[model samples]
Target: MQQRVLWSAVMVAALVLAGCGSAARPASPSGGPQQEQRKLVVWDWKSGEAATATYVEKVKADFAGRHPGVTVEFVAQPFDQYYTLLGTAAQSRKGPDVMLFNGGGQIRDRVDSLLPLEQHVAQDRSRLAGWDAFTKDGKIYAAPVTLQGHPIYYNKTLYEKAGLDPANPPRTWDEFVRACSAVKKATGAACLALGNKEGFGIQFFMSGLGSGILTPQEYDDWIAGKRDWSSPHVRRIFELWKEAGDKGLNSDGANSTAMFTDVFRVFESGKAAHIIGLMSDVGHWKDFGEFLPPDKLGVMRAPVVTGGATPSLPYDGGIGYAVARWTKDPELAADLVHSLTSADALAAFSSAAGAISSDTTIDVSRAGPAVAAIVPEIRTGRPALHVALSAKTLDLMGRLSQQLLSGSATVDKAVEQLAAADRAG
Candidate 1:
């Protein structure tokens, strides 16, 4: 499944031992026979899910083959309960040797439990795309493994049926809205398949819009309570969403739809013309093969809102590998992370998962034409809102977006609620 990237800012305020300084090394494995029988445990939310277990098994087999002396224990955590289980285990100092750290709230709040990987990173800088998202106060805590950037996925047949030139996709917000409206009018297909059933979907849309519509400093100010959520930029985004809802351009049953299955199905069935999702979706075209013809399926950058100061920078999200601070074998943990994220491993993983690697050394062309076309956008230096805000602030914004989308609250009311939530936190 293609993962959605949200735009909540994750601020790093806590201080920790910098990798440049001498911190006591973790105790090595016991000597002799015990050392030779080392084992590493990994808890991954992505691997355990029914939808992705097959891919997980492949990763496990590959890792085991690469390290004959090492035994890998793979544990899958349900998406809804993964964090809670991780938190409980982390507090007990019994967390997995290596774990998958997500981009936003989870990483922000649990970073203190993670070991700094700057030492490992310095030795193998090629494993990461950029240190900004995984670094804190000059210390790198995680090694980014995959790159998932937001992009527009449109069905070609729907475009043509709506009188749009399938060869030409919209490049601006005005053109995008007009094209979507046209698709709705001509074919009665939803212009865009958006699932609001889970608040994450709405948050993802906000992040994509926030990326191009707000300045980095403005985002920081919003998170710091220096600026109000009722500002024109924030209001404009919500207004656009409201407009989309009114135009019947959004997925049917959006209020109650399951994001990956139901919402994406609209596009897959040719009942929707477009979807704004991770670039990874371009690789998993088989799921929506019926609706998207090979030649007609179009991939493009997310449209920039008119009058926005920032250029189009898509929201990025994916999992990174982080070692536990309390691990008994830090070097082995680092080695595992490095091996999994190595250029060779990345190529294999990307091939299996249909994902893009963060490693700059890898030739993205290996992922095929569709993914190759989208790599440049992922590498753009636009700031991610999720990488910029405090964890608590991000949670508040996500809840506020949900309230607005559900009609349980007005945009202005939601903004006021966010202000209160920010102050309370």
Candidate 2:
């Protein structure tokens, strides 16, 4: 199948305690005849899912082998409530020994309650590439497990039906619109599948299409904490969002569509030609490959909207594991964190869960051409624009995007709100 174009631990108990500040170790008593069993509680949303069972087991097995007296217990929580639970635990100064986090704002915002893993995972640093997302204030707080980004995935079969060359997908905004018009005219399929009900649709649109509209300097600056939401190029992205809806480029009821599976299903069922999708998890090449044949899948850069906008992949750390600051044994917990990210463990995850492992050493050539095309782009990739936004701003953007599509809000108004929010943070 050839689909072209597309896309650490730990220290001694005493040393860790000193590094992490005072924390009690209930498992190890001051004077006991026999040492009590050590249990390291891990919090994450993925372990309960069947897809990652093997990966979790591999990590547990490895950690158990290294630390005979410790037992690892994974507490799977609903992702929607995971952060809330973590926040509660943080306030109480007690929680799981280890916790899983999505890179970017999620982890960055919560670093105050996490132990810095830089010194502990120094050996693994060179083997990983997504450290930026999990880093804050020059300190690394978590170890990345997957690489996530928004990539434009298209259907070659749809392209062919539209009379467009599959190998030559659109490279510019004008060309993309023409191609979409052709697609709608020939096959009657929507040009793009969008699910904004949760507002993630806007986020994906902003990141996926941003590379084409913003210049390289603008893109870099946005992620570097110097966002210019009022820039004409930046404003253009929001305009396109409304334009896509106004032009009927997206499937019907887009504002009510859920991004997780609804938007993907639209594309999967051949109702739409393209989607702004993830790299590692659901809605990615692997998931799409199930419905569309390898040769029918294509990955593309964001179509160039403004001139001089060099197309570069936009991505950052997908998901990672961080040690809770109030753990009884920081060293032991950090060791488990390192074990979870071990090459062998990540390899199992990549194979079983179809994840794009954070370990750069992991072999992925066998995954397919779509992944092949996406991986190399990392060298020129910049962090996603939305990842830099605070959660509050993202929530606001989602609502504003819906308004834009509905003609209730203009680009100027949306940008004004975003600029205010971004500047506030």
Candidate 3:
């Protein structure tokens, strides 16, 4: 009887040991649908090095708090190489789930790789402003983060030195040119700092010419081969470009000089009376306080050329965030985009980058004087020709401008080349 009882106890112990072994089996590594991890990766170029680092830290903390099982990783690159790097990563399908896209034709080039945010936008419409800019073929691919508008920034002291009233800025192209010529003749200052290296200075000049040279529909028609390149309006603008270069109103050696930094320095040093690039430069007058006094600065809309069709308006451009079509976690990617483009996030980003937010809900006053001066123009729907052109046309225009400015191509010849390139493209 005792031997039988001992045998029964041993059998029960063995059964308990088998049960423990089954319970200790490892879980599936693939997350098995029930325990999936939530995480996202984002790429942006606007954040300053130090500010981005700090902002990323805060984002991580905040995101983790809101999403107990999720994590976010951010990578910021320099502006010059940002797009190139993104293009490479996208081809390999290793790009960030969310990325910031610079406006212009380039946005069209990468449209296929981007996830349309229409559903997201429909769910959260107020987070967006100027949605028309990011729509292609009726699909929304990006959310505008800031209204990158260009306003003429001039030196108040230089205006006074040229015997011009500092309070009254030029309202027309003729007035602007005369004022510039006066400043150049009186104080030996450069009327404008231009560089062909970046193509922005020339593009800005062309945009200031307004709609007469090419209306949005005309430009589209030209690109589509319906309009002639040698149209009188087109020739007129080309002739005007040549005239500006010949009159000595632009920077010296602008054709060969890739010296954008020097150009900005010249403007800041009061040697150049005006700059017609980003509105942020006005704020830079304060950020780079030693370069120029904030109180000595003035802002105005880029003047309209005499015969242009569209009214003088501030041209706008900026970086936008889009999700990748092949992203493994679309929901998470959408969430990340939503967070970064939120009103609060935009306010923080604008403060960090010294830019204006695309969120109309955010107060433009928050961006301070420089950005505020241009807000009215943005809100009023001033048409800009450059922002309306297709990407291929823009590249051809850039090349043509470079050739024209370098004395390698005549105005008539450049126009022909541009038309030819448009045909080939």
Candidate 4:
């Protein structure tokens, strides 16, 4: 509800931001330089990272070549305050002309302030994947730069300590539990590395394991907003989430632990045997590979928990670039978004920053075994369950997840709250 309110606040406070836009100026005669040079600002969390230096450079180079008179400034905001800053900017009419956004509800809910990119990015439709994440009302609002997925990653050394074959991970929920149990008994390591301080743990947990719990059709329905929170399958997900904490599968102080680099460290340092990890950005194969041997980073599907449930990949469009509706030149901003997702620029992104380029055509065979494994499954992968939820519901889920972990809330109570939030959305 607070999220909805914040957006409503944006709509009310920034009425002019959405209502007015600068008209497109005619191109200079004989294709010469314009009378007035233009500048576009881009904001994102990734631009400041050392690994993304090449990605940023690539974007600037591509855009500069396309528009010599335009000056583009990159502002890398700290992610914790990203949305707050975005809201303030929208309200103040001082935000970037083009900005980065997470797919799903984050972008969808802000469409009142965004320019739809459907026609602008038509050429990229067939070349890139994960468009559904940034599309609402059949109109695309951004261009995806990377595809993100939750793949169960295990430490081969930890598997060996559990007396399990490193090459063959468990294929069923029962076997998975036994493996966790064995790891706990043999090495004193937590079975899984979990951090939920910000409630992101449950988000990863739902997406990472949802494939094994929900029937294929039910999974589709959930993504389509036909969620049945009280249904046995839906309730079962919450049940298992609680059960994992009760069983001591996750490391201690799980709720206090940050889900970002901290959770990845828990797995990298071998304090835990496994993690439900991302395909791109941090906490993934490349980040772990920097600390562990490439061969030791293993990717596995969600183990099946219910009869007839098929385990497949779950993912969404990671981060993407969007043009603001208030921009002086929507096409100019859209073109910058285009350059941001260009093949060469994204190829540099994949290799330089360890992101899985949304352009599936990019070869990742040499990235690592884990990525090699994840890429092949992208064709059949489904959007993550949490990604389908609205921002308000996600925040609610995060709180409920913590209560469930600490035995403070029953699965039923959590479901009821979520059902209400979902309906409100």
Candidate 5:
């Protein structure tokens, strides 16, 4: 694949460049050790956000205290161009010493350019819970800072207005459909707030509802890279996506809506009863809790569609930091990553940025009822289904998903394309 070829070529160039640089360093005429400059540049999209300011400051302070001589600079890039910029940096061997990454395929595809941080972060392994997302081939390339997962969030006020019991939510797919009908009939609100403009709705829907659609074996196999795109259950997922759109379960202009803050805003404004939301950062319990009463926000499991399916929480590392392999001091950079994931720093991040800290020891009981319901399921949660697919395949899926919504692409054709992509990889 393209990633493998790129990795091989990049690693070779990096090694050669590193070798030449080390050989070129001159020795002191008197044979005394020469002083070396200590500076580290870190890049991330979150650093510039207002909510993350305090968290970023805490991390910088902690890292500076631990590394007295090091001058650390944090470059905050726009999220839309983050990956493209990083790819260019990698190709040119001029990237930052440390950088942030989302877990799963994002970090996995770029592992060749990152220093494995397993040994460096061994001490905090027991305290953190999202390591699997940042690990590849038994090596940890990054330290997770937040736990992100899709949790079904509903508006209790909407439920009550629809003549449904706010105390109890639907437990099956049929029941969920019935509730949606009631919500639509009583209140003109849609059942779900869906935004697919960037093709993110299908990603959220697939992971958010996958636990309820696929059998345990099938689900595990998909995550393990043994996906069966033609499987009946897999087809069922696409069918449901189309069905939801055709039946008007989602709000108007679903395909034109954006996912990031817009999707959350729709749900927060009470335009829909349910949404597949995240556990941390933007579209989560904490964000919605600000608009709706904390008690009015409820979290529910994905309603079961297949007989053998069992709904468990779907999650992984939300975001993490990695040390670049080309850094002058890998250990020092890795140490900075460790500092970023420290308990105090993560706690500050969770508090100020509304993120679920990857550190399991952080208390989130006061976060709200939605978080309370989600945290308990983390122990049994599986990695999200979308996160397993490569970036190329994901992009393809997103495009196909749009056609599915508009009835331009049949489920069969979508599956065929996806199967071919998976096989090609």
Candidate 6:
């Protein structure tokens, strides 16, 4: 996607011992064999999932073709602690040969322990979409697997029940509010499904609605590192977040709800009319399509909140695999990374896991119309606003967002704190 909407890799680093699976032991005294077979250890969150089994098998088969006797062990780590565990492994200098990471600050903050893959992945520059997320100082670190975005996902059946046209979604902020009100009155569904126990709701809200608030030039400038956290439009984002919670748009107990689990269920079960959700993996078209009928799953653009505002997809790299600096064979490890993002492998990932693969060549038409609507928007999509912030700044933003939702912080206060945090970077 280039500057248009570069897909980046969100690597959830996995750690496996170097010696635990290594084949570097000296030849046996008997000369029956020179040494045990080579083994490559990899860490990722998706390896253990049934949905991505085909993807894992594809990469394993591809790598085995290149190196017959080498064993590949994949250890799946819980995402909530993936980075923390990877940190401990990095300090010990005995991390796995390969690991996964989230694109943006998640990968950018830890580049010191990663290998630059530019030379090894040159052949994939034209094939993949999200390289920039894992890149730093003009060097690439990981290959992106999925292009993640925040699109306003709605339940079409709810819209229809509210006497609103499913095909003609709201276009303006006032209109959106009116439509949401209609849904609430007619169907008793919450206007929106939200959870902030992890404080991800603000990230989704900001990115999903940012395009319709910031001008195109302003948006690009923010991505280019000229962020104005104190801008009125930026403050408005926080205001809207607070307003949604206060005005009963969001479901009850939003503060304690886990977005990764409960919030999606609310939307899927027809309790909520809309959610600012992902374009890949869980909480996306595929998950909703599985629950609701495919035709009832709708992807809507951000409503126009300000005059002259234009809406577009907000996304970055989802997750990607990167080679660790301590790996014994950089070339062999890079080969594994290459095989992981290969067309066949990624195609399987897209088909089985419902990921928006970074390999744009993979056809997603069969997945449903929602996927069809999303794929075309990447060309004009902006980098996710939340992804553009530094790690510390984003953490602060999350806390401040939670405070705002809980009535402990005002929009101005939240923006001011974010401005200072961002400036400190």
lDDT of 5 by residue, 205-319 (tens): 9999999999999999999889998799999999999999998999888888999778889999999999999988789888898799999999899999999899999999999
Backbone clashes in each candidate structure, one number apiece? 4, 2, 1, 0, 0, 15
Question: Each candidate's lDDT (Cα)?
Answer: 0.66, 0.87, 0.67, 0.89, 0.89, 0.87
lDDT (10s digit) by residue, model 1, range 160-197: 88899877777678888899888888988887888766
Give the per-residue lDDT digits (tens) of candidate 2, residues 41-83: 9999999988888898899899989998789999999988999
In model 3, residue pairs whose N, Cα or C atoms come closer than 3 Å (at least 3 residues apart or on different chains), thus clashing, are: 212-309
Q: State, as a TM-score between 0 and 1, how close model 4 is to the true structure.
A: 0.90
TM per candidate:
0.80, 0.89, 0.81, 0.90, 0.90, 0.89
Model 2 whole-model lDDT (C-alpha atoms):
0.87
Model 6 scores a C-alpha lDDT of 0.87
Residue 316 Cα positional deviation in candidate 5, in Å, after optimal superposition: 0.8
Tell me how candidate 4 scores on lDDT.
0.89
Worst 10 contiguous positions by lDDT, candidate 3: 23-32
Write model 6 residue lDDT over 1-425, tens digit each, in one string: 56433333222122232234433322222123233438889999888999888889999999999999998999999987999899888776687989998999989988878888999999999988877788888989999999998999999999999999999999999999999999999999998899888888788888999998888877888988899776788778888888988899998888788889789999999999999999887899988876899899999999998888899999888999998887777888899999989999999998898888898888887989899999899888879888888888877887888898789988888888888889898
Name the Cα RMSD for model 4: 7.2
Better-scoring candidate (lDDT), 2 or 4: 4
lDDT of 3 at 166: 82
Give the per-residue lDDT of model 3 (tens digit) for 174-217.
Answer: 89899998898889988887766655556666665544356555
Check candidate 1 and list the clashing pairs.
8-386, 9-389, 10-389, 11-389
lDDT of 4 at 414: 94
Off by over 4 Å in 4: 1-37
